[model samples]
Target: MCAASAFVGYSYYENQLLADTTTHLLEHYNSNYVIQNLQGTVVNTWVSWNLIQGQTLHVSIVNDANLPEDKITAIKDAILSNGTITVDDSLLHEGPQGTSSTRYKGWEGALANLQSLPTKFYIPQSFAISEGSNGAGDVVITLTNDENPDGLSGYTKSISDGNQILKSKITIYQSSQLSAMQLGAITRHEFGHALGLAHSTDPSDLMHATIRTDYPYISGCDIDAIKGLYSGDERSQVMCQ
Candidate 1:
């Protein structure tokens, strides 16, 4: 009788532990932005902010000190139109020692990267470019020689109104050192962040945490992520009306 009683007690203890573990898992799953397939299986995870369609956003360019106006214009042109800007590497002025390179990416390259995404959003000449101005822009692309000890290429900051993006700021570091292709890649990546995309685990993806030096571009998974974000499905937290 004592042996049977001990077996029943052990079973009860195991069941309690299983119940606790399940509860914890459910809480964790519920708190994050989880991506699932039609089969009701989790595929990936990331957080995003929705951008309402037909809302125009203005982007301003703030150049580094002593930078030429034409150089700033090149960046501005790239962001405004899906066109290429011929970069004369020989004409680029020198920057800090061991911190500058002759390569620069064109604006079309970045636009191409964004265009590759299978999203329904359009990029008209909605963004405006500017020089040093006190007025605030919906999105600011600041070029700076800030201390980049970690060798980061670019960074982006954004504000969202719980459901949609209100504004965003993209900072490009060592802009002179980057080749046109690299600049385009970085721009595309930062723009993805501004559009409420999180990093992808795949190294080849444009939204990966680390930008690949070799012509890194967007992937089908990245496209699917954006489509899912705007799909208005149950997995999405923000939906467009």
Candidate 2:
């Protein structure tokens, strides 16, 4: 009788432990973004440049409209704030090939000294202004005066194969109306997209579909989301803490 009682007690303890472990795992899995496959199995889905390329993302800046020097500088500064920027005028511009307009030339001369920038935040990634052919894994930023019917200030389109992002194109529209500060905010937001971040539900967050924040810089929540993304958390939309 005692042997049977001991056996029952041990079985109860083992079952309870397993139950607790399963609950913990479920909680963790549900917290991240997941999708159901055709086979009826849940799977994680996330896209990131780091998954294919290394920590450094090469960038090519093409000023098609010849936005003022300060505006161009603002764009570079915004990128530098997140990571280091190496200016190389020699990099062949990417995207929209065969334009003979000399006005579409890439920015010449070095970017303004980083120390002059008012603020600098650090992330794991870096950017290089490089010359390369189209679809060569470069983030091409183009400044243009084209007006969008949707009235968007900027737009980012990323090309990906599977979970890896091959390249990205960021176009800034209506450059004449935006001030330097406004241009910087828009650049930061689009750059986030280039890094594989989706829109955030928070209006105050930089990743919002429409930027309305007075202090439109990258926040801690944005950093946390990036860390989660690179770590394989597939969240449909970022939620602020």
Candidate 3:
């Protein structure tokens, strides 16, 4: 009887410790992730595919812009790559150091402490290109020479139900003027939006508002932000710093 009572007490203590740790980690995440709106209201605007829809994001390329085979392939490849998210441990450690800013030492430290916490988080998704859009996919990419009213090279619009994304459309403008490499970069940036990523504060990152980076590939910060979004955390934007 005494042994059983001791065991029960230990269990309660362990559970409480876990809860406290999780709370701290969440606080840390919010400090770095959450944003405030113009009305001074805390808004967590990040949205992404729910578990069901994200299992497989079927994509259909309309190719209406009549891009060449190479450009078409580049666009397809870019979509596929961004769909696969892999967090870089190096990046987690590269951010601002010291615990003065937060209780945790750094992103790596926070993630390490969070590893034991049980939470519903996003898993990496797979992307498949459906042939001719035989009603197989919810994402549509249209390549067109039609210039955007905003004069942007690419644009993406996503429809979401609540915080869950339902479908997305990507429009690439002035495709004729873009080289295959340029098309690939633009496709990557737009596809990031289709996958529910907001623009990064870092201009050097691929998800920036403008595609000016010489290497317009997905960055570690982008992956980390997506992971946070799919985890159901509402963050308006994510920054590498």
Candidate 4:
């Protein structure tokens, strides 16, 4: 039942799943990101952008929480650093009610959890989690409620807060049994929220309106957006406000 919310910590455990890991000096790149192979099988990823200052991210996962807590911080770091995160684990199974306890069915409870987290960053206003048929599937979480159903607790970070407020909670399917596809998509999408991102219209992007496992990591636009948010802020400036 325990869900581990991983950020940078996951990179230390499981094998790096990101197909693109090319990161180098962005000043010399012609594209938003440059992908290079370190070896025959390994790739190095990098993005060219800066984020607003004073963004402190927090990661937390409890039982049935959809993420493993031990990897929460690593997860946050990866999201902030644009998918440079990983974790190490034997892949242990948590009980129905392990250390992870963050759970909810609908909007009220889930939103409350996000608002209550201890951090300066905050989530943006978003549509509540509801049930409906989206053209992509029975439920697609499009920008509008009737358009699509995200199927998981939706999230968006606040630029005003440097996208650090992750007090938002997550919601799992009530069926008590979910497929790996659903879990991966949901985790990726919600974590996107934690990183201050929104759904991209492009299907190739993980933030696509439809909840699918097309890309399990952040994209170039996502990296530029995050860095833009974090780049301008000076450490001392945040303290005054």
TM-score of each: 0.53, 0.61, 0.64, 0.35
Encode model 2's per-residue lDDT on 151-173: one tens digit a residue.
56778766666666666788787
Model 4 root-mean-square deviation? 19.2
lDDT of 3 by residue, 1-241 (tens): 9999999999999999977854432222110112233444544566676655336567898876777788887777676542333334334344444411122111222233334444355433566785463433667887788967656677776666666666777777767767676777777777767767778777656777765554466665776776677566777365786
Native-to-model Cα distance after best TM-score fit, residue 195 in candidate 2, in Å: 0.4
lDDT of 1 at 130: 63
Off by over 4 Å in 4: 1-56, 64-166, 232-241
lDDT score, candidate 2, position 101: 16
Off by over 4 Å in 1: 1-53, 69-74, 81-126, 218-220, 233-241
Per-residue lDDT of model 1, residues 44-134, tens digit only: 4333444454345566667664456565654554455443333232333223344422222332333345543444444321445666655
Candidate number with greatest TM-score = 3
Question: Cα deviation in Å at residue 183, candidate 4?
Answer: 1.7
Task: Encode model 4's per-residue lDDT on 1-241: one tens digit a residue.
Answer: 1235564467644444331221111011110111122222222221111213322323333333333433333322322332232211111122233333122222222333344333333332123223223222111222222211433233332222222331333333321222333334455555544433445555434556554322344444444343333343222110100
Report the lDDT of model 2 for residue 188: 78
> By descending TM-score, how would the candidates be arranged?
3, 2, 1, 4
Best by lDDT: 3
Q: Please report, in order, the local distance difference test score of every candidate based on alpha carbons.
A: 0.51, 0.59, 0.61, 0.32
